[model samples]
Target: MAELLSNSFPATPTGTRFWAVDKILLTYLAFTTILILGWWSRVEDAGMLFAAHVVGVALVVFEVKRPNRTTWIFRNWYALPFVASCYKEMALLIPAVRQTDADQWLADLDFRLWSVHPTVWLERVQTPALTEFLQIVYTLFVPAVLLIPLLIWRKRRPEEFQYYAFLIALGYLASYVGYLIVPARGPRFLLRNLQHVPLQGMWLFQIMQSTLDRLESAHYDCFPSGHTELTIIAWWASRAISKRLFRVYFTYTPLIIFATVYLRYHYTVDVMAGILLAAILIWSAPALYRKLSREA
Candidate 1:
């Protein structure tokens, strides 16, 4: 059974198409489409979606034609996020299993941690130069999303990539569970006591807010930040590949994460919890995977 499940989704041989979909490629195409369509109106986001599809198709074609499995793997880092998303959703649903008071968890934390601004100093450094640098650093997380696949392609390290992906999924799942078990309406949603600070990026904030508003469940799970978890997993995975350049690049992910609070999106406690969550996930991932692998 373990061997069968392990082979269920072999992340190799670009020529071998699983279910005629090329599992990783199909996931990328599906997620990109879902994000674009779910964000803007169908017609409005169509052009960008089409172009993205074209590029994705081209990349998959190149990967599939490439003689090596390594080239095929990195071309599809987009698949990892989908896996994480599933776990996050699972986390949200977990509280219901025990009939716990999720709202109380959210409210209590609001009074305990987010009430004071520990890193208020960061907001003061919001000069054009600093903001520009932070913005660059913040955007670095985007590329980290692609790093795992690149590592897989470069080193043919699919096992490591799979392990990293599993860790990310579990981290997100734990975070969402934290959300349910300790639902906090993030700092942005609870601005009554907070000092009003400019986020600078109104458009970006609105887009993100709208998405959260549209979510069907667990709106108050703002503690143990998802962005932080994602960045942490990416950074750790980057380090695993021994790519010093990307390891350094991923190191900056936490700074941008701090910027999330100064940008007035998350609270100081949320950021701290996120960092802590990353540590826990990093520590637990290998052991957990080993257990799961055995059970498989």
Candidate 2:
């Protein structure tokens, strides 16, 4: 009877438990937790959801090669707050967008943030061709950043996995910070008011309306530009994966970054500040990760 039952159940590895967390699994779990939490928080509308789908598939592939359960559960505790923070941010953004202009709020808070002088100096930052171009370029950052890990994984560069993962996590974290610090109305609103230019970019206009809807749909929360922040970080992180290819993309990174403004999706100030924010994260994170890894 025992043998029958044993046979009836799928056989387990000779001595291993039915589920055991491994490092890869832990990382996978962490990725899923972050993505879900980020999306559920509604901080950036569909951004987190998109990330979850993309990253979730990659994690599944990783787990298929090397299964682990224990590591996932053990590390689950560490991801709790970050997930909570993601949710907290979403809640704040919705109401914050409605209740007040995040930009003015920051101004009132005495932070005195400044975007780079270059974005504001430009005269045609809101042209239709430029706006669409900017949106398309900014959107490419996700694929660009994710491609690195996919390549490394395909090549079985396990040693570099953590580094890639760290970049991914830190890049996202910096974006979250930018959202909190600068929440200002983007280029379209700014242009319509400050420059009195007619908004001609239909796609940009629609996205802007959708974004505003998201903010007012729940609250108000636009300040630091996630589009700018994440795009820069992804562009920089591309270098870590391949200098040869990085050189190619690096040239366009600025143009793409600039598109955020020309399209009226981000304030020139937001892009400038976001660049600085990405630089700070990219510069400091490697050493910080090494230190934390050693301590761990």
Top of the candidates by lDDT: 1
lDDT of 2 by residue, 1-296 (tens): 23422222122222222112123334544554564455454445545544654564465445444446533322222232333345344454444333345654433332244443223444455567655565556556556656665556445554465465665566555455455444455444533445545545546655754654564343223455555666666666567568886886677677766665554456555666677777887788777666655522
Candidate 2 residue 157 Cα shift, in angstroms, is: 1.7
Whole-model lDDT per candidate: 0.55, 0.51
On residues 103-137, what C-alpha lDDT tens digit does candidate 1 reach at each position? 33443454576554433435566655555555555
Q: List candidate 1 stretches off by more than 4 Å.
A: 1-81, 84-115, 118-123, 128-142, 192-197, 201-218
| RMSD (Cα, Å) of model 2 | 10.5
Clash tally, candidates in order: 4, 24
> TM-score of predicted model 1?
0.57
What TM-score fits each model?
Answer: 0.57, 0.57
